[model samples]
Target: MSEKNRDGKRTARERLAVEREKQKSAEKRRRTLIVGAGVVCVLGLAAVIGVLAANAGKDKKGSEEAGPVVAPSGAQGKDSLAIPVGKDGAKSTLTVWEDFRCPACQAFEAAYRPTLHELADAGKLRVEYHLVRLIDGNLGGSGSLRAANAAACAQDAGKFREYHDVLYANQPEESDDAFGSDDRLIELAGKVQGLDTPAFRKCVKDGTHNSWVNKSHQAFEAGHFGGTPTVLFGGKNIYQDQSMTPAKLKEMVEAANRG
Candidate 1:
């Protein structure tokens, strides 16, 4: 009955209005879908980039330690570090690079020290210990720097060897709290015999001798370190097959002398 009905057909304007309403709904749905998809794409890209960045950083840390590289694949570190250091300052030499916090190194020290001392004191061989502890930051922020410096201090007091044994003997388990704190190390340094606490404390606190320790830790990354207790027998590694033991070291040193 209205003017629109009087026209006997829907007015073109009214039809156009209905069509526009349907189009508006469809357009809204399309816009929402586009926005959602864009968000998903951005998030996915960020995740991928994050993973790659992490891997790259780990690789860089590893490579830095690989140079001055000693390949642990053949002859261990024997030829490279000179193992079986002869007693009595003999013809052969045994040099050890060890980390106190390293369980393997401690084990090796326990196993070999007795026999090595017997030989050294008997005037058959000259055995030397090189303290190494630099890998802590890479290994979870438990570097051996504090202990290394402490050993340096002991070295100054002519108790380098004795303090070395005490440090490892009292080593705590690996943890962020363990190696990072100097308190525990200082306390342990006090335990060594013939060590002047004041002089040793000054040496360690100054941190000058830590550089020597850092070098060996750097050796680890290059695969030069098969693990703790890496002994160099006449610059060659004797027990290339397994981690070192005192008995095994004793046998290896004796064998090297026969050669």
Candidate 2:
């Protein structure tokens, strides 16, 4: 072969080798970029999953802090929120929504206690008392909640009626937060025989029925009543009537019993 022809062929082979090297370098760069992109995508997904897990944990913790709604023993009606005070066979049902720290509730209880007792004892009427925290919400104190919880504790001890009377009889002023003290509540429990036991004290101190009282208050708000001392008879709001009295209540109950 001529020397010039050999040189030209060798140069052509060298050029081909350089071109192949350039292609290999480009491919390596492309593969590196693809791998880096994949890593970025994986890290982004991990961050998203971490945020979701954290939010889920917060939700679970909030639910735990809210605790459970435990209804009292022998509580009737929806969610077992009503504390029944008479025989189940009574002809008429009187629904009373009351807050222990409410002066109006105390007045209503004072006015109707005897008649209510008479009707309940005679099996002519059944009183379903629903305790609420209206005063606590309005007055910005925990007295209503504490007292309602104590009342539920009393119900657990089978001394709800007597203790309920004692609470109303000794209720503080409208703005007073006297009932907020667990000691005072436990002290008052002494008025009722067999009600000041260790179990009762523990129930009161632990606020065992605080959640239940909160649920009852929620039910009251859902009911959309005007305020505390909401007394209902035969599906009518008798407490709203200006002329309503214990005599009138007794007469209505007797009439219902007759029917």
Candidate 3:
């Protein structure tokens, strides 16, 4: 063969090899892009599932027919787990609607715990606790409902007040879903004497009071309440008034008793 023709054939072979290499590199890039897209899609799906599971309790109508929601003994209003703080038939009724996951409710409880307990212990008035789950609905977590259910379970064990106080005392950050876990709830129950029993554990884990929690939230909405820590004195919504204080609450109760 002619030298020029041989050289030209070699050059052609070299160019073909380069083209093949470029094709292989492009195919590798394409595969990488496809793999990356698949990974993103999977991650996005996982995030969506996580959000849905966390927010499962946000729906007020969920699992309403799950079981019979037994209200606590002597519970007032519809689906409430009322813990009476004073003597029966005390002239005044101080109704409170609170969510365990609510920061404002925690603050209210802290500020008024002393005065309210003092008045109740003195038999001057009756405080009716109506547990609700506004926080769970507003925030994307089941902590409020789970905590409320646990409180109802406490009611069954005859330690509602003790458990209620401890729950608020150990309340996690409003945004955290720690209370959504039954283990954390049971752990907190240890703080209340005689509350960490087998029955209590079963009730908390099984979500025995989930239906009741839903019902209580229904009642709150039915009553047209705006948010958590709603305080009503003599059927008058008093929590909306920011000026109201613990001292004022005492005076209001005294006057109601006087009437």
Candidate 4:
């Protein structure tokens, strides 16, 4: 072969080899980038999963720490959520759902308490008081729950009616969370004769029926009632009637008793 031709051929082969090496390097770089991206995606997903798992663990721990639901003594109705205040054989049933911190509830109690007492005492009507924490959810305080728990403690002492009346009579302003204090609740217990014993004080302070009160509130929510002081007579929501009054309630109870 001629020297020039040989030189040209050698140069061509060298250029070909260089081009092949460039292609291989580019392929390797592409593969590396793809593998790196996949690793990053996997790590990001794992981080999110870890955070979610940690949050779920925290929620489960909190639920476990809440303890069990303990109903008060002599609690009646479904799930023992109702505190009964009269003879069981009464002709009519009056279900009252009330919140201690609700101004409307206090007003209702002030208006109808006399008739309720008279009817209950005469064994003409049985009152099932289901206490709730509506004000706590609305106004951001624990007074309603605390007061309900205190009332449950009174039920244990067989003085629920007296203490319940005292609670309404001495209810704080709608914005005041005075009932949240265990000392205040115990102090009120003094108003009800034979209701301020050590056991009652302990029950009030320790929130013995807190879980029960929460359950009752849940029941109230499930009922889909409008608000606190939801009074039901013979399965009818009498409190919603604009014409409902203490005298009207008394007449209804008498009519039901006659039937």
Top lDDT: which candidate number?
A: 4
What are the per-residue Cα lDDT tens digits for candidate 3 across 66-90? 7778675556654445656678878
- Residue-level lDDT of model 1, residues 1-259, one tens digit each, is 7886767566676888899999998999765542343333233233423443443444322222332332111112423322123344465577676666666566556656788777776665677565555334424333465676566666656666677778768777644436445566677766776565776666555554554445545554354444445567766665344454566666665776676
| lDDT, candidates in the order shown | 0.55, 0.79, 0.75, 0.80
RMSD of each: 21.3, 27.3, 17.5, 24.2
Model 1 regions more than 4 Å off: 1-88, 219-223, 242-248, 251-259
> Candidate 1 local accuracy as lDDT?
0.55
lDDT for predicted candidate 4 compared with the true structure: 0.80
Model 3 lDDT, full chain set: 0.75
lDDT score of residue 228 within candidate 2: 66
lDDT leaderboard ranking: 4, 2, 3, 1
- Determine the C-alpha RMSD for candidate 2 after optimal superposition of all C-alphas: 27.3
lDDT per residue as tens, model 2, 1-259 = 9999999999999999999999999999765542343333233323433444443443221111265787888999999999999999999999999888776677678778999999999989999999987655444457788899899999998999999999988988757888988999999999999999999999988888888887887788688776667789877888767687899989988988898
- Model 4 bad stretches (over 4 Å): 1-65
- Residue-level lDDT for 137 in candidate 1: 44
Q: Tell me each candidate's TM-score.
A: 0.58, 0.74, 0.73, 0.75
Model 2 per-residue lDDT at 9: 100
| Poorest 10 consecutive residues by lDDT, candidate 3 | 37-46
